[model samples]
Target: NTLDYDYTNEEYDLIYNPLKMQGKKEVEVEVWDYNKVGKNDIIGVVNIDILPSKNKETQIELFIQPKNDKGEVQSNLNTDQKLGKISFSMIYIPEDDYLKRLRDAELKKRKTEQELIRQKELEEQRRLDEIKRIADEQRRLEEEKRRQQEALNAQYIKGYVQFKNISVSNLKKMDFIGKSDPFVLFKAGESSQQTTVAKNVLDYQYLNEEYEVLYDPSVMQGKHEIEVEVYDQDSVTKNDIIGAVSVDILPSLNQERQFDLFLQPQKDKKDDSSKSETSSTNSDKKLGKVSFSMNYISEQDWIKNFKQEQLRKQKIKDEIIKQKELEEQKIKDEIQRRLDEQKRIEEEKRKQKEALDAQYIKGVVQFKNISVSNLKKMDLIGKNDPFVLFKAGELTKQTTTAKNTLNYDYLNESYELLYDPAVMQGKHEIEVEVYDQDSLTKNDLIGAVNVDV
Candidate 1:
């Protein structure tokens, strides 16, 4: 038997029918180049020995030169010429072993299928968990938004409306007897208040009637209304609605406090049963009128206005205090400046008096080229810095320092001696002292002398 095919790639798997021989046998494999024009050319051929005992192992062989019909390598061709390679496996199994191998393969396939299904289930569960997480997050966000709106609306509630001195006039006659007993009812939103009945009168005035209603303008923007209904009292039947008037709250709040509401007639139940709609003429029938004083004041506005007034008063008070402080500081500064000027004037006058008295000195001690030689050292390692001091009565004068020199000469210096006839009438003794200057301590006195002036 021969198997032939065309393959385009490097790797391929081929299956062949079982060989007829058992145990061990040799199989010859041939490689050929196909030609469409004539017989195919023989590329190479190889003989491979098959052992049934090692059936699980595959044999790989490199092809050599082709063999002749005698089953011997061709001597005419170059036998070692390199060609392509081939690999194949041959297994021989009895009937029982073959059936066992098939069962094992089936079990492996089922295990692989079960593993794929488990992975799919895990993926689905993870997807569902992600969806639940997203849903929970959205709900939390919406709940937070709702709470924020609720908080905002709480601040939007403003204040209240007060209705006082309620009365009604010229109510319709509903009964067969005398003037109908009439009362007034005021309703706003979910709240209602009524007045005592004034029996047997066409006109009625309610005594000590007052109603205060809480107002939240955020919820009352366009829909809020006040309904004033006049009802006539009857002992045996339902109270008759003489008329009713509805006034929009926001506009009425802006208008004058006194309201004269002309009522509109109630719908007749008998007429409503017989017809689908009432005519405009019948619906426009006039009833009585209700009179009341309505007042609305926002507590938020009142508190804000009160705070502004307090702030204005406090600002005025602070301004007055600041002005007073500024005035007092200004006066204190003026007084200090005057005191400083007085001290400066006194100093100048004293200096002038000293100059005038110095002009009258009776005697003068003149110093020129007054030198000192060989003064003792006052420091650890330098020549003495020397100076001379002259004193006559209460006056003293000092010469300039000679600066690290043993000899110092007072080149230009003078001293005046006052001759008070009461104290020093004549010759005064002048004291001359030579000293070494030490900045860190007292001056070191070296010598002294008295000179008669």
Candidate 2:
């Protein structure tokens, strides 16, 4: 018998089934809660497999809830408990056995997949390493072939050759065949030989694959030992040699030495032809007498031109000066216009202030006269001097003269003054003088009277 347990949703299901054919099977299952199970919570079973004569202590694993219904597991568990015992003969198997086998196969398949992925990574690394190794070998072979070609072109011999007493017509072709720098040798006679050295060959051409010829006739006709040296473009001497050849002087035969020479025309001869034609034309025009004064007018024309240019410049300068004067005059006129406008405005303001001050002084003078007349008519002054009476009443006073004074006080509604004998009581002459605070005279009245007072 095998015992299997599965857990779901905080609950566990235990299935006990016989493995093979068996008689009576009795299993005492003891489960101990380890991580999250409490007391009497089954977590595993001992003696889960029992046969007829044999008791198998198969510790069957029980799936306990990793978390309880509250989504938390206890840190420790209590002791084991005997869940129950089962006794039965060979019977049916549980359905969870097939499900457990399927779960084990899936776990094995996942492990195999992880191994395959690791092997693929290792194979790709090996392929990259192999590609880098092949590229390094091709660069080494190309450097070896370039060094062998320069060694074969550096070997030759050196000598000089000269020619004498041999006509240049006799030697139509000359070839110096060796690795040496050879020269043409010229022989003068059988016993006496004059040799001219050829420093180097000229007009050398390679006719075939291996032979080269010097084609200049002057070097071939020379009677000296020619010093020849073959060099490369770097001026390194590859070959040097000296050789001599005798030139045989032949007696004069039927040969006339004739040569063609070229001469250029003289300058005066070409000028004389043109002068003769001019003279002939001048004779024909003798009657007309084409007279010309060989006079130089450049300086005079330059002076005139300079004077004209100066006149033009002076005109331009005058124009510029006139424009500047006009600009300045315009600016001055603008300033004067602004000044006139400002003066006009100031004059108008002065007139307006004078008018306003005149009106204000007139109103004040009228108020003083009215106040003095009303005070005298209403018997508002005491019998002592009106100035003294006003002073006693805490009014302010100004003595305009020895006999005339201004007595004024301010009430809540209006300003009042008293002029005692200057303004009479029944028919008084109120000589009231009103002045500004600066004591400058504003107005004066002679007999501002009230009839009743």
TM of each candidate vs. truth: 0.28, 0.16
Query: In candidate 1, what are the lDDT values of residues 1-453, reduced to their tens digit?
Result: 234443555443233335655442556667777789999877777666545434365645454666678867564333466555544554544556666977997898898889889988988898999899989999999999889867745544466667887888877788898878998887656667778888898787887888866665555543345667789999899998898766545444434477776667664657422211112322434577778887655667646755998999999999999999999999999999999998999889878856755554565566566888877776788888888888766677888888998876666665555545335433346789998888989988988998865
Off by over 4 Å in 1: 1-158, 217-222, 252-256, 267-284, 299-453
Off by over 4 Å in 2: 1-301, 363-453
Q: How close is candidate 2 to the true structure, as a TM-score?
A: 0.16
Q: Specify the poorest-scoring 10-residue window by lDDT in model 2.
A: 287-296
lDDT of 2 by residue, 133-199 (tens): 6655544444443343223211111111122122111111123432222222222212222222222
Task: Compute the lDDT of residue 436 as modeled in candidate 1.
Answer: 85
